[model samples]
Target: MIPPATAPLFLEQAGWPHAAIVPLAGDASFRRYFRVIEGGRRAVLMDAPPPTEDPRPFIAIAEHLCQQGFAAPAILARDLNEGLVLIEDFGDLRLKEYLEDQPGEELAVYARAIDLLADLHQRPVADVPPYDRAVYLREAGLLTEWYAPATGLVVDAPAYVAAWEAVLPLVEQGSAPVVTVLRDYHAENIMLIDRPEAKGFNAHGLGLLDFQDALAGHPAYDLVSLLQDARRDVPAETEAAMLAHYKAVATPGADFDAAYAILGAQRNAKIIGIFTRLWKRDGKARYLSYMPRMWGLLERDLAHPALAPVADWFAANIPADKRHDALVAFAPE
Candidate 1:
């Protein structure tokens, strides 16, 4: 629901009336989206309230993507002070929904997504923070901070940090040349843009969303986000094929496999902690249901030889049987 204090200002800025606005589903962030219809014209009103989040990064990133010839939404109007921006509506067809409706087209859809990433990797990082080891270590630390408490386990913080420190350098050494990494490049954040004449595998057929948290980092990070998605299950064969396709096109070095696995494990580990925090701190329990899937992904990534130290940490701290939903595992009877 739009805040009563900001509703009038948002409507006035978008030229939308009370009757023409319909709420849209929001993601994990504090941003709220609404579909505004005025005179049969449709646009999306993004209300990202102040203090918690600012719309400046999103606005800048969207413009950057558009300039790069990608299918990012155009900003129709904006009020940074009010934390509102009216943007082009990409319609209701997110890539995840499209795949759900047309399961047969999964491979093709993912192929296009991978191709988009290939194109993105060719561009140098723009105005964004670097995804360095400090960032990686801090993010991965969430697992120990949140998940441990949620599961009634006490992890040795110094040992956990040491384990990650050992693995992160290998990840950096093995990754492809640095590029703008869309921190959350999963299926849910992708859209299938309608562009029939879009040429080549690296064209603008795919739409990008939820890139406000984008960073300058290894290319393998986003690939991991896509193939080893948290909210959805991607087949092992499909993931393998997509990885091969990316390798052929992008020509990343042989070290790409090790980097992908290390980054995948890092990402999944952060997600486990984030999900647990969502349930305990934000009171969002639905994220708990995805924990088992996330654990499976983490386990797979940990199997890589590069992740031996972090893998050992997980094995010692979180037993396989105990790595289920922390809420359920530690719930009061």
Candidate 2:
């Protein structure tokens, strides 16, 4: 993750000329983050270089989340030409690390996250793209696009699309009172903030990040993202309890279970393709370590009755040895 060459200059123009820049992190996309520190002040520089990535969605989403009294990072400065934005920094602590260090807090921490989602779903939807059928097909198609080729399988792509078409209407039924779904509302992306946060929504120091891809989607989408996390192993009991907690806290649609299960399968399948692509195309092998976990999550989602078509697609196409068990023994060249 090379620091973008324009970073120093951007910081200088953003009024942090003398600030020290340290690499913070990079995600699945073309974006990169750096922590800029000067004296006692600090901010995160998001270098979302153009031609591949844009920072506008992230900026707009952050503002929207703030206007709604949620905990997205505050954008301080920007330079559109270089695709750089200086924003408030939520230091190193993330829910994944904190919970790993204190496993007992899993239920409580997850309950808070679920509470935030409940609050969010109750608010007005953000002015963003709708998570419609095209988006669903494109995402679910990743499994065939990347993972299938990587594993040397000839997937029935048309059948896969047909399967999704069959079940996606069920998904639409559960999107009642649609809200902005933060597409990556998982453990690692959620920061445990040390500063005072917004009062409403039970944000309670949970600093949101990586929401540039937020979409006007089903209420269950974010919940599925949180509980069926690919990177973190959320306990089954904790997942179940938090889900019940969400139902108690929010007014979910009658088909919320079907919607949740479908989204879970879709998201987990997307992640499997993504992680596989990160290895085969991007040459990032570390993501491969999370594949088994993703497969496990995907299977759990597949068991739900609503996912029969998609589930059947997987069973007919991705054989068991070529699935999670095979992935466990697989490695990139």
Best by lDDT: 2
Q: Write the per-residue lDDT of candidate 1 for residues 1-333, one digit (tens) a residue.
A: 754367666677566765377788677878988887778678788888898889999988988888887888888888888788888787777888899999999989898898888998997576999899999999998999999887778878899899889978765764358788888999888877675632211264777888988898888899999999999999999999999999888957657888899899889989999988888988777888888899889999999998999888888888765686546653333
User: Which pairs clash (backbone N, Cα, C closer than 3 Å) in model 1?
Assistant: none
Candidate 1's error at 276, in angstroms? 0.6
Worst 10 residues of 1 by lDDT: 195-204
Residue-level error in angstroms, candidate 1, position 37: 0.7
- Evaluated against the true structure, the overall lDDT of model 1 is 0.83
How much is 13 displaced in model 1, in angstroms?
3.8
RMSD of each: 2.8, 2.1
Residue-wise C-alpha lDDT for candidate 2, range 101-211, written one tens digit per residue: 998888888888898888888888899999999999999888899989878899899999999999999878754668889999999899887565432223466889899
Best by TM-score: 2
